[model samples]
Target: MSEKIIFAGTPDFAAEHLKALIEAKYNIIAVYTQPDRPSGRGHKLTPSPVKSLALEHNIPVFTPVNFKEEADKAQFESLQADLAVVVAYGLILPERILNAPRLGCINVHGSLLPQWRGAAPIQRALLSGQDKTGVTIMQIVKELDAGDMLYKKEIEITTQDTSGTLFERLASCGAQALVEAMPKILAQELVPQKQDSALVTYAQKLSKDESPLNFNHSAKQLSLQVRGLNPWPVATTTFDEVVYKVFLAQELSAEQVALLGKIDDLENGAIVQVSSEGITVKCAEGCLLLQTIQAPGKGRVSAGDFARSKKDLFVRGKCFA
Candidate 1:
């Protein structure tokens, strides 16, 4: 527990782990996070959540663009840290930097090892409709999240989970898992298990291009898309040439299955019904209920509220492009 530690991360997820280590009273010698970037309406440079948290603790913070520079690499080595803990650090570390620490580095990844190993694991897991996913504490190999596993804590992927919600849960899960693994790692009691290459699956970064909702897909698939993209590049639909962001969505209930059968021949994406509850849009195989939506330059509102404000647009037989 006296080992000098270097904490590296960027987002709120990483901040959570940093907070855990601090609360556990670990010797966090320094912190590493991405450089401040322009954010929000004014585009002012904003510190990452990790940086802010570290600063609050009066911890020395490093924001090197990368270890590509000799000075940056040397600065890291000068610390002579026993271990480096990385989580959602954004920057890909070089092998030299990874080896700078005496005990090398370990990553708290947001996925079960050998699968969903990339930048957007939580979102990809939901998008793929996985029944369960988990966090993995692994060695920091040169390859992208292709490290040997140290420990894993699996959790169920509930039907109600969105990437945003999963982010919060996984951050907490990963934080506890990391803190639990640290002592064993320092004591050399933990064994590393090699990953199964055959079972590997990557979760590529989410894209704005992937945000558009396509009614051509089944309602179930569309529902996944909506959940996966929530809180970032939200699932969108074109209505009257305006882009409307979709938040909450659902497939028809067992009783409502009869309703879809009635309009089994109607054009997909056409409005089936608009009630006080939501706007039902027919899909390729079934109907999807749009529960919440957001218009350009406006706050998110329930689908029923949007319908009331734009009654003409939600009229039956009208199509959403």
Candidate 2:
């Protein structure tokens, strides 16, 4: 309990672990988060979720741009921490900083290691339509996420789980996993297993080019896109040059597919129906119901509301193209 812990992280997911450590009475001596950057309509600087929580606890906080400078590494070394706990910390710690702590560094990674070893694991899992994914506690090496696995906890990935919702679950799961693994790690009771290079899969950072939904894919695949991209570079489709963010969607069932055929001229991306339920669009293999959406420059609204407000734009046979 008296161990000097240094926490490094930047997002809400990381904050959850920091919170658990605080609640569990871990001696967190300092928190290192990314520097505040411009955000929102006003473009005003804002503290990260992890930084905000650390400050509230009166823990010493540091926001260095990077550990490229020797002085920055020295400042970290000055902490004399027994362990460094990292979770979604945007900056990569140099080997010098990683070794500063007496116990070296460990991370609460979002996905099962030897897999999803990069910036966007949660999103990648959903986007790939994986049935399940989990958290990995691993030693932090210089190689990006290529570390010895300390512990792991798996969770099911449901059809309804969006990246945002999955993020919430993973945050809680990662926090619990980290708290449970910490003591074992310090006691040296936990054995570290080297990651299998053969099974490694990289979770590359998402890009804006991946934002637009491609109806040429199957409804199920498109549905995954809708869920995977929610809350960042969100899945979108343009009609009349107006981008509509698809927040919620579902694939058509067999019965629902039977209900089609009323519109023979329909093509992929064609508006199938605009009912109070949602806006149904035809995909290459099936139909997808857009349940929630955000119109251009507007707040999120039910797909029905969007359709009702623009009846002609959503009429049957009108293509998303």
Candidate 3:
């Protein structure tokens, strides 16, 4: 018989693992996800991706705000699940709920444990210019993401990878890793390994304050920031009292750097040049080629196209704060 599993998670990342379990016929008895929240321009209540998938498969779902309540704890224990799998579950599971399942709880974390041990691991990895990251399946403990690891799989982080793209790749990777580890988990053949305390790194959640572009940073760092925050809280700068969001950027070439040096009295954030290649902006250490940008109330457009239509706005010497 298949193992009786209790699944808990939210967001698209979590939903992917739940979907994989269903396809694998793991006998999911119930799913726990965050409560529906108002979303989009209309502010309509929208169910989480996990909840939507659970209902489609006719699986029972719970959205308890927390397990602190005695009733909620009792109901969870009543499930009598052999194992519990968590992936990006927003809520913290108290000790009572954590020990409810016979095999205890296992988490499918986005980053290799002890590296990025908190929220927003994928974005953190890209923002820090990490060349690679991976997923880890671990036994959840009291501390956050401090669980002992059972399995792991690594993947490369390409220069072109944004948080959105990396998220999709890691989600799929986590699903496959979890599925492959299931047989060993069922037989208790896998030995969990303790993480090194000295190697622990935290990925605090992203905030609006992190979205603004600071030209004082090197061109390479700024480029990573732009890509890391893409599709959410995008990197922005002030131009003529309006916010200009930067979606894509790259470091300028040596030739471009030489051209920038020729321009006198140019400050960081100043528009150095605009051409078919892109819009070059001066930075503290180097120049950045802005590939895609968006003005307030406007859709994203190529820097070249935007420069053509708004020549007066992007003229050389005009500065962005």
Candidate 4:
């Protein structure tokens, strides 16, 4: 028999998992997602992806402003759910709600836990230059992502993987892992191991003010930062007192490094030269080749186009703030 599950989630990533569960024929009794909030440039209020998916499946959805309220808690417990699945739910589940389900709550986290255990796992992993990271299905406890692992799947960190890309892959992988873990979870055959508190690392939520690219960091570190923050709050820097976003970049190749010799020792964001490939800029420890960039009030363009558009900005000794 399928377990009577209560699903809770908010973003598209979470919705993917919910869809997988529903497609697998799980008896989803209800869904709980955060209340709608203003979004997009127009700031229109829209239902969360999870809510939309639940509505399509003919499952009831609850958008509680306060989970602690008597009505909200009563409504949740009334489902008498056998289990609860949560992914990026945005709202905290109190002890009563956590223990209400017969099999307790399970969460799909985007990082290898005991590390990056908070609001921005995907971004943190990429920013830290982690060569490998992946999803972890765990038994949810009261603490933040401090749960026992039920399943995990690792993925390689390619030189080009951004937080946005990594998130999509992890979300899909998590859905598969969650579906497979459900059977063991229902049969009571899964073992829950305790996480080591001493080794914990937190992934604090990112903010718009954090997008400025610091050239004082090493080439690899700066590159990772740019990639992690891309597509939202993208890394920005000032050139000729005008802010420009670094859309794509990488460490300079040996050929380009030879061409940029000696001049590469200049201060941060100093454009050494523009070769056939791209423009070389000095970083704290090495050099970065700007592949794509966007000038203030302009759309993104290749380094060659940007250099051509603003010749003075790409001069040999000019530094970007």
Local lDDT at 128 for model 1: 99
For model 4, state the Cα shift of residue 290 in Å.
1.5
List runs of model 3 lying over 4 Å from the truth.
Answer: 255-265
TM-score of every candidate: 0.96, 0.95, 0.95, 0.95
Best by TM-score: 1
Instruction: State candidate 3's TM-score.
Output: 0.95
For model 2, name the residue pairs that clash. none
Clashing pairs in 4: none
The stretch of ten residues in a row with the least summed lDDT in candidate 2 is: 257-266
Clashing pairs in 1: none
Q: What is the C-alpha lDDT profile of model 3 across 5-81, one tens digit per residue?
A: 99999999999999999998889999999999999999999999999999999999999988888998999899999
lDDT of 3 at 63: 93
Candidate with more favorable, higher TM-score: 1 or 4: 1
Backbone Cα, N, C clashes tallied per candidate: 0, 0, 0, 0
Mind giving the per-residue lDDT tens digits that candidate 2 earns over 139-190?
A: 9999999999999999999998999999999999999998898899888899
Ranking 1 against 4 by lDDT, winner:
1
| lDDT (tens digit, per residue) of candidate 4 on 1-321 | 567999999999999999999989999989999898898999999999999999998999899987879999999888999999999998889999999999899999999888899989989989888899888899888988988988888888889888889888888888998988888998889888888889799999988788887778877887887899987889888888888888788876567567656864477878888765567788877788878888778788888766866676588878878
Per-residue lDDT for 180 in model 2?
Answer: 92
